[model samples]
Target: MKRLRSKYTKGEEVKFISHLDLLRVIQRALRRADIKVAFSQGFNPHPRISFGPALMVGATTEGDYMDVDVEEDISPHEFKERMNEVLPSGIKIVEVFEVDVRDSLSSRIKGADYLVEVFLKKEVEGLEEAVKRFMAKDTIEIEKETKKGKKLVDLKSYLEEFYLIDMNGERAKFYVKMKLGEGSPNPFHLLKAFNEYIGDAFDLEYYKIHRKNMFLE
Candidate 1:
């Protein structure tokens, strides 16, 4: 058995695909490439492939990672070439490498870095002051509805990094990092909280949002 690890990009054209549909596409590509992927032993056998954390819909990502177990030992370069030849547009393999079975992409991921570009239709005074005040607070509590129910959660603790890159009258850029694991806050949720705190200081919308990288501590 051989374990292969690959990094892929989800471009804007394919960002609408759900996580399950993305998995199906990859499986089909592997089959078309004639790669012998191992299957799980069960009543309903499935490929022995695993991917990192699920990506939110409408979010483009360049740091997505996946691991697959193949029955045949194939060189990483050849594997990449074969897969790229069959993969549909907007989904491309960036890199492939042999990985130790003991290691997993999910366990090693500590956080994700995102670059958000916001466009402003209008501006209000004291926008910067509101941002500073929000960042300075001891805790920012927001209500979220989960399967269990609506609950108030503190977002301050999960923010590993946060800063505004630039903000003109018409546009703004933000760089943020949210830690993963227990109690980790979603980056989008944090942005929503920021917008609410600003209280219509600026009519802001996310023009572009891209996940730049994922890191391990």
Candidate 2:
């Protein structure tokens, strides 16, 4: 068996699908492409396919990763060609290569960068000042609901970088980098905290978020 790591894109068409649904789509595509993925050894065997991180619904991604163990020793180029032919329009395999079977893709991810564009109901002044104020604080807390209950999470620690990329009268775009995995906050949480800090100037729902890149260690 050979372990293959693939980098794919999640475009606007497939942004609304859940992570589980995306997995199903990929699995079906693999079967249709005639790729022999290795199955787990058990009564109810399942494909040995794994993904890096779960992307938020309604958000697009430029770079996402998946690792699959295939029974056949197919070349990376042939595998990519086969998979792309079967995958839907929105999801496309851009790169594929053989990987060491010892380490998984999710284990190597450390951080992710996001591009967020906010559409305001009305023009809000001092946007830059509000952003500065948010970053200047010692702690930026927001309520996060877990299985236990709602708890306040300090976003400042997970937030690595934040800055405005573009702004207009009723629209603003931002670049954000935050730590990923294990209790880390997503980009939406960071935006929620910022909106609260700025006295809820922008509507939380009126925004476009796209994951720009994932940083792996």
Candidate 3:
């Protein structure tokens, strides 16, 4: 069996697709592309495919990774070519290659980086002061709704990186990289918490949010 990782663009509208559906689409796409993917030996065999972490709906990515297992050996270049040929317009495979025999992508996925773009209809209220005060806090507590009830934790403590800048608002596009914990919320929601930290200074309706990139470690 051979395993490979590929990068694909989360095309505009298709970005709304749930991660589960996205996985199914790619599984079928591989079959249509004529690649023989290896299936697990079990009552209900399934392809060995996975994504870095789930993406929130309505977010696009330039660096989305997926691992695929194929039944036969095919050079990475050829695999990339074949997959690209079969993928839909919104989704295009950019790179492909054999992954390490022992190493896996999951082991490297430390967290994800996000970029959010918010436009100014009216000047954000107390924006500058809010940014300074929010970042200055050694820890920021956020209330998260859970199965049992709301759980409060220090979000700033968990944050690997975060920033609030204006876009042209271009780069003010709130760009942040955060550690992805098991069952953690999406970064977009984390932005909501950030908004609170800034005394609700950001205009949510005017914001055009997009997940620009994701990284491993």
Which candidate number has the best TM-score?
A: 2
Residues 156-217, candidate 2: write the lDDT tens digits: 98899998888888888999998888667788898877877777767777899999888878
The Cα error of candidate 3 at residue 203, in Å, is: 3.5
What are the models' TM-scores?
Answer: 0.89, 0.95, 0.86
Give the per-residue lDDT of model 3 (tens digit) for 1-217: 8789887788786877988888888987899889998887989998888788777777788787888888887888998888888877788888777877565777777777777776554346556566567767888777777788998867776577666665453224666777766556666566677676555655666555566666765
Badly placed stretches (over 4 Å) of model 2 are none
Per residue, candidate 1 scores C-alpha lDDT tens digits across 65-105 of: 88989999799999999999999999999999998877877
Among all candidates shown, the one with the greatest lDDT: 2
Q: Quick one: ranking by lDDT, best first?
A: 2, 1, 3
